[model samples]
Target: MTDLQIGNHLRKLRFLKGEMTQAQLSKNVGVTRQTIVALETSRYAPSLELAMKLACVFDCGVDDLFFWINLEDAKSKYSSDGQ
Candidate 1:
């Protein structure tokens, strides 16, 4: 079985929301813009409370915003792209 890694669709959600900036989303979520950046880049995983807050801002459920991917899938996707 593959390990799980958390991922998010924050960038797409922000774009759908009138091209909302990272700063705007962070402010609405009560977090720093860096946190929003990190989440969008998959460099960070939000706490449950933060996830709920983000979902609220997008008017969606947390599961719709974030998801667990198989680590092997991530590795292959990135590695094959030379990332």
Candidate 2:
């Protein structure tokens, strides 16, 4: 499994926007409710298209919803070679 960690701030935004249901958001984004659940739980990483769709739904930038943890970098023993 990938060690990357992604945040689902969209869920918070959706909640703020009249407590929107995942099903509704899913329909707007052309995805299944389970996809929304996975996204909210950070168990799945959406594609660029899905990310953009979600951003549109939340009325926010993709960066505002998802972020990379860079776990490998955090545990790196040596500086990266500029190869």
Candidate 3:
């Protein structure tokens, strides 16, 4: 099975949003600055509610903020058999 990874554009989006600070975003989302750091570093995946809140803050779709990355493609080449 392929390893599915969650990726985000939090840092880029934050900068685009008036150079918003990590602390500011965390405050808006009712979380700690560390949480924002974790998000920017891709060390943590936000919960559904958190994701929604972030999207709301940016006035964008959730898909615009986060996405799925197939890690297997990055790590090695492989083929899947049709089932």
Candidate 4:
């Protein structure tokens, strides 16, 4: 199976927003600072509600923040059938 991963641009967005701090963003999103850190580091994935809150904070859509990375090879060698 492909090792799909979720990536985000939270750190960049925060910096773009006048160097917004993790603590401030956490407070605005009602999450712990550690949660913000985790999100920025791609160590944790946010819930849909949290994602929406973040999008609202930056006035951007969720697609602007998060993206998917498919870690599978071109031929999908990990799969039984490389279709």
The number of clashing residue pairs in model 1 is: 0
Name every residue pair that clashes in candidate 4: none
For candidate 3, lDDT tens digit of each residue in 1-83?
Answer: 87887899999999999999999999999999999999888789999999999999999999999998888886565444332
lDDT (10s digit) by residue, model 4, range 1-83: 76877789999999999999999999999999999999987789899999999999999999999988776752365675755
lDDT of 4: 0.90
Candidate 3 or 1, higher lDDT:
1
Candidate 1 lDDT for residue 15: 98
Against the hidden reference, what TM-scores do the models get?
Answer: 0.85, 0.76, 0.87, 0.83
User: Once superposed on the true structure, which residue ranges of model 4 sit more than 4 Å away at CA?
Assistant: 73-83
* Residues forming the 10-long window of minimal summed lDDT in candidate 2: 74-83
Error of 1 at 46 (Å): 0.5
Q: Scored by CA lDDT, what does every candidate get? A: 0.92, 0.86, 0.91, 0.90
Q: lDDT, candidate 3, residue 61?
A: 98
Model number with the top lDDT: 1
Residue 20, model 4, lDDT = 98
Clashes of 2: 0
lDDT of 3: 0.91
Lowest lDDT sum, 10 consecutive residues, model 3, at 74-83
